[model samples]
Target: MPHPPVLIAGAGPSGLVLALILLKNGVPVRIIDKERTHRIGSRGAGLHPRTLELYAMLGVLDDILNNAGKIVPTASYDFGELVPKSTMLLLKYHEATPDVPHANTAALNQDRHEEILRAHLAKLSCTVELGAELRSFEQSADSVVARIVKTAEDGTQSEETATFDWLVGTDGAHSVVRKQLGLSFLGETRTETIFALGDIKVEEGLDPNFWHMWNVGPKMILMRPHGVTSTMFNFMLKGRSEHLMNKTLTSDEFAEEFYSLTDRRDVKFGEAAWMSNYRPNIRMVDKMHQGRVFVAGDAAHCHSPAGGQGLNSSVQDSGNLGWKLALVHKGLTPTDLLDTYNEERLRVIAHMLGLTTALLDRNDRGVGEPGKKEFKMHQHGDAMRMLSVNYRGSSIISQAAGAAGAESDPYAEAAGAPVQAAYRAPDAPELVPAGTQGAATRLFEVFSVSAHTVLVFGGDTDARAPVVDALARFPPGIVHAVLLLGQEHAPPSDAPRFGAVFEDRAGHAYRGYGADADALTVVVVRPDGVVGVVASNAEAVEQYFRRILIAV
Candidate 1:
């Protein structure tokens, strides 16, 4: 290998996603988990719209969509009588559009999600080393010396000293890497809200199409079906349910509690698959990284599971850090780029903690959506969906226009909003290829997980040469050039080298990117599917890369 493999301390979704993204960028990784085997259960099941879009970029959306179902409508019950109506917790589903392809959440168990990610990583010749733990580490200027303990199948343990170029802590809340770094995990644990969650089987007369929630006196119980027809469900006991916390893990005790709460003896309880306890920990680390070591996912931030933000946020955290880490490790970009990880993520995480905490508070206050404004809570809004989350104020972002007032709202960018630099790049379909037999494609398909995509609109052969030439100066395979021309103009026969050329016949390419087709407009999409630079000419585009890439 050119450099020592990047050491990832955890093999959860956060770690696995990070390892996969780096592997896609040709960066070596060593993913380890302290657990002896894979975790089984639907611990966190709601995959938000933004998360689905990210999975598409990683080439895993097809498998995820094939296995998961849309968020099931939750059926609320006062004791045993079912409520007249039930609504999606993530809100009403929106039809998939060219700009927002993934408009609804997917209900896939965390266990199965990890399995899909691990299988994809294996295709790249990488596997999660189970039972191997990063016990401790010391970081120098150049490399990280880590002490790892590996447990064999025979229950014997062996310890070894290994060196890695970089270290990332995707480990959970009790992270060894974060503890070793001495970073403060600042904030309070919500003692008022604690719950027992597990995966169990309900082998009787219960509709698997709806998420069942029952309220007994002051306590709350929810049984969310794991899949459409599967007998498995993720059960959660909240509010005044302390009496059943310890007893739910044993024999027929859980069944007795369920019967007592709902007074429904028609349902039979079967063997439990996975079980655990959860408390609302509204907390985040003051800093995400120190020296060459870093923390992400639950280790970096943890909050209530009110809006199903924990798993999605963790995956996004790793995704945000993966591309930046790869660029710096490959010596293609300066280390200054790595600092943006902390800057960008901290802002988003802080806002998210507040949002999730508010949701929990609303649910406790018995505030509902509209007519049922009794306890069926609502109003997480588009922000909770996470598609609008942006880094418009980041130091690395560069733009000639279209982003003057972007920093006011953290979740400002959405499907219909103007394409601003440092925000998640929007998708535009109906781009007809020029002088080729290929069918029409979308901007989402052109975006890469391993390279930056440069979309050039409305520049002629002579004028487009500089932008094309400037991109060519950078290291090959790191930058992709795309030309989006108007429908009236023919394809440039003597044009400079371009990765793809398309005619904006439907005018979506221009409308989606918020650019006119009369002048040269360059929009650079980063490997993580973020717009890095929105410029008018080649000189400005070249300057943006100089800030990101070496020898540009």
Candidate 2:
């Protein structure tokens, strides 16, 4: 059977990752962006710990970490003088333990993040088609027909109609796909607050280690440094910003406003690289998908960038949908699996918007005021680090015995809760692969992005073949079975024939997953690095996947 390409609208982080995941899974994709050129600006610069873990799975973490900046402390000012560290609007950092490899947040421009994703896509022979806009789309019972407009270098435009198996709209807030689908995007627009933001060159006086901020009730100035030599910054100007948003504020005029706020003569502002205004139009659609057409990222939800959940949630949306779509494309899974993406992300995003909106409200209520003293009330804290985000209540997750998944607490992950089905699988280092002279690897490295990983913990050799056989009933490569043996258990000499066998000599995997070493437990992990099922035996593992994957 021939598979038609999956048409993706928008080339932002969401679209790029979704396209990358699909392409990597041998699913053809056509990713298009309406923009004529690559967008510039440090929009949505905060990258949470969980997003870094996604990047690690995507094989782009090294480049992202190397090129990205650290989350610098906000050198807040009360009237004029610099405030203490305790009072700073800073992002709190945490140490990386064995279970949590990426505990700290990363700072990188949204454009650069997209560029890294594009590079990864290129490795798979997939490139984003810029200036190719999906103007409108219509879906039938099986395929979606799209009208795409392509703009040339000379600015001439040509329209073409194409058909696809699936259409994903990552086209941002004003999505044509969503509009065409007529999905109800209901929410309130914060007309009271507006911010004039710019990416410009700052020649002197601003410290790179500290993000400079000046506090004035209803009026605030925030400048976070970026780019090479730390001379460039993403600056925000607030306070009756209606004039700024309405009037044509030039580079020089914007610079003058910066000087007026900072009252600093030493600092020199260069020409503006990019400028835009934001008022935080918080909104979300009732349904993320309608038939063959689906919406992810900004198209599905919009909110303030206070807690930095917007972009992270958008990327996570792509990951959660991509693999399932790939399975459906490969005819190895029922289309019903696609329903989980909507159900899982909708609640998560709703909770995320609530948190970010509350943060914005707190900032509105004088978190920036001089002598204001509430601990991290204005800062990104341990809460909402996005590490603990889970799909605990999703239909696909199969957990019994009254586990943490039954709690339905969207904030459970932030509380450092115990292991649960549909939770982000914890990472464990020092798992020595059976053979290779005891060379060790992390559990994260073993998980695949294109297949469901079944971890068989502390199982005897006699029970291993049945587990492998049950999983082999599915399409090859759709499922990966790995055996986790404790120190007391000796791996058989023919372990290579069985599958991946990792010896947990230090018992990190067992402790991390909260599984008994003496018990033969099976943990089925989804392609997005989430534990989908924790079963007591191989029969239950196969049964769990049967609810998701169509057996061959």
Candidate 3:
């Protein structure tokens, strides 16, 4: 196969998603994995709403929702039958609030999730070059030179060097990229060995959609329903299991241990698919980008999958980085924008580490001490686990105060314009009624789509004159122009106000910019619908368009 300009070091979720995003934009990408076949292990098994939103953007949400397991909204919090409480609070607090239309999460095994990603990857005709390992890579100012070895089925190997504009490492925890780059992974490794995990089919009369947790003093047992086929059983032991770590255990030993610990011999196992004893360790790479090469997913950070965030976070990391890389390669943006990757992700990682560790500490009992203590308590950290991520403080978003009220619309009754000067909300309103009239409603419609919108405020029907004349005079593709009135807050019923003139309802273009409604100010939102620039004055709007919009 011919070499592509961009080379991705791993074909797991992150690498594949990154490849797909780039490929969609006509960027050439080559994805390679060391494994001879795709992973079949039911590794990570949950997808948050934010992830689903990303999948939606990738145009695969429905496919994923159809293929993955649907997580039940209900959860049970109990430790050794002592204290029992509902887990609704955790779900409510952590999940995305209803203010944004998209909410909730889906749960599925990692292997199945990868299968979905692989299916999408295939459409681009980018095949996974299996049995190929990245041995080393060198990065320079303009490009990356890397070497890989292709291992034949019978064990013979050959090496070759490839040059690419950029190299991304989505490799797992034992990342060769980190070693080659000499980047330090700073964090403590918490060593506790008595843990074992395997996937088993539940009894014929059982249900597997809800997440089930059993806390027996120092030991914590978790059962998560996969698809119609099976459930994953995880046992967290307080002490070290040297023998189990050294050699595999029989299915009878697993059954015996389960009955002895929980006294429920009814729990059963099918043919063991995969079994392993592992120690939980937490760590994060000091940096994500090094010149022409960048690391993501488990390569950039590794933490205990206690909150089921490993795969989710990794996919999100790619979500954050993919678009930026595409824009940079297309010369639509500066490469400096890539710096925001480490800044935004590291901050999120620190917080997730704290929450996950806190949750684990609640269930932790000293090593070698089993059944001595009860469960600490479980609470939902879904919002932090799922949404509310912001790049607000990043260099990408200019730190300017937002404006408020009807006077906020700059195009309102412009000079020589026969438009009414009706007052509207000075700032963007927090929550507008579904049918609320005013600039805020219009701004909401504009922010829904994934583009920078040029809102001509207070434009009466004929007021389209000045803006239309100016827009036609400006270069094409610089900005999307939409005329709005101060009084018409609700979107047009027959035709959507944003996206295209006759388009259906979607997101607000540029986050309801160019109006000073209590809910809106002149705002330029990123394609992801997060605010990038906030304008309070009409001059600021003009200047923003002059500087940023004109270039695009």
Candidate 4:
């Protein structure tokens, strides 16, 4: 029987990332979007450090970084007087360390970010099917048959049916998959407050280096520059209570409000490229999947855009699901592995919803200070970066005999502790191979989303023998092993029997992994860049894989 394709609904960031990941793993996929063209708005523009690391694994970080903007200072104004401390909340972007290379956030409009992902997908010989809407789907014990409607610009519509082994919904809040699954999007809509958002071209004198904000009593207006171009800006206007009634505004009317809020005669506004009157809704389904069908991104959860977690969390949902789906499709693991997707993400999404809701509430009550804004763009603490999010309690993670207890908070780091199972694998620099002269390699470069990476640390050949023997039993391409030798040990001229051998000249990889140089240690990393097990012996390494991977 031919392999059934994985059907993905919606071509937004979540769907595109999922497609790219599955395609990279050589999994057949079919992604469909209802929209006729790509999106153009600056929705969810903040790219946190954790999301950037995932993008690095997906091989699209360079394109995103090159096209994106760095976080800028915030300038606040009250009435006509510039605030004594113009900067909104004294917060500074954290500098990058050896372990955390992407410690700061970057800004790229959602539309452009999706375009980058779409371009990368094209390189894999896959293209998103546009104007194809998922009307409905029916799933059995093993496969899903979906009905899709294709509408043309000339007012013609055609219906077709396709069968796939699995279905994933990455469509926005109004997801047909979730609706058809009868999942309750249980939450409240903040009808008491409403915001107007638009992408508009600003005339000269509006400095693009700073995020400008104006607060006059109950009304607040914010202008944020699009990084690549100084002329374009994302404009947001907030109102509360009776003043927050939903209504559309013309370009001239929006500009009039902008001028009135800023009280700046020198600045002028051009046409509004994209505009929307939105009331924040905080809603999410109880689960992400039912049977062979799954929901992700806004389809699974949605909340106010206060902390800029919507797109980042959505992309992460895809990242968390992509590898497990690929492994199950390849028969490397049982279908039970897929169940963890919902269990792992739902908890994080719940916490995220609460975080964003609290931020929104704070924004509603004006900052106590006259000229200061409490919740400035990029003012969020370390948690907003999402690097600390983990799946320690995941069913698939097999902790070694003496592994440390799971971190209390999913987004909290366990300082001064060994790398715990299910925690993100931190990146380490300056790794020199046996005979590479002075060249070095980084840990992230050795990790692949398509296979499990096993790092064996030992000082000499004898200490590394057991891991080498155990790894040889595994099939090629399914597992990649690297024998990391301490600086004092010299490798043989020939490569190891299985996998590459590198020398930890600077011991950064050793220390970063919290491994003792004298002890023989084995670290098993999952496809999602999470450390699955930290084994003391090679037997523990073999046992851990036995729990997750199918027999060769």
Model 4 weakest lDDT span, ten residues long = 400-409
Off by over 4 Å in 3: 73-99, 203-206, 228-248, 365-377, 402-499, 502-522, 536-552
What are the runs in model 4 whose C-alpha is more than 4 Å off? 1-4, 82-85, 88-91, 240-244, 370-378, 400-407, 492-495
Q: Per-residue lDDT of 171-282 in model 2, one digit per residue for the tens?
A: 9999998999999999999887888887988877777777888767767888888844678899877873344566646888887776667666667778888887788889
Give the TM-score of each candidate: 0.94, 0.94, 0.77, 0.94
**Residue-level error in angstroms, candidate 1, position 525:** 0.6
lDDT of each: 0.82, 0.81, 0.60, 0.81
Per-residue CA lDDT of model 1 for 510-531, tens digit only, reads 8777777678889999887888
What are the runs in model 2 whose C-alpha is more than 4 Å off?
1-4, 80-89, 240-245, 368-375, 401-407, 414-417
**Residues 1-552 of candidate 3: C-alpha lDDT, one tens digit per residue:** 657889999998888888887786678898999988777777677677667766765777678888775555333434323222443323443333323334655666778788888888888798788989999998888889999999889889999899999999998889999889988888867664347776655563234545555455555565556664555443333332335544555666665555555555545676656666666677888888878789999898887766667787888788777766766776666677788778667776666676667656665742122222332234454344454554434545454444222123211222221111111111132333234432233333443223345544433333334344444544444346543423335544422333333111232322333333343233444444344455444444455444433242
lDDT of 1 at 114: 96
As for model 3, its CA RMSD to the true structure in angstroms is: 8.4
Tens digit of per-residue lDDT, candidate 4, span 1-552: 553389999999999999998988889898989988887988888998888888888889999999998888778776655442457532357888778898888999888998999999999888988889999999999789999999888868999888899999998899999999999899999876778998988877577888887866578888899963568999888762343346677777787776666667667778888998888999999999889899999999989988788999999999889998998888888888888888788888888898888888877876554334554433676788888888766667875344443334566665546587878888887888776786788888888878889887754567767777788888667788887777766775335564777878888888888777678888898878888888877777888877777873
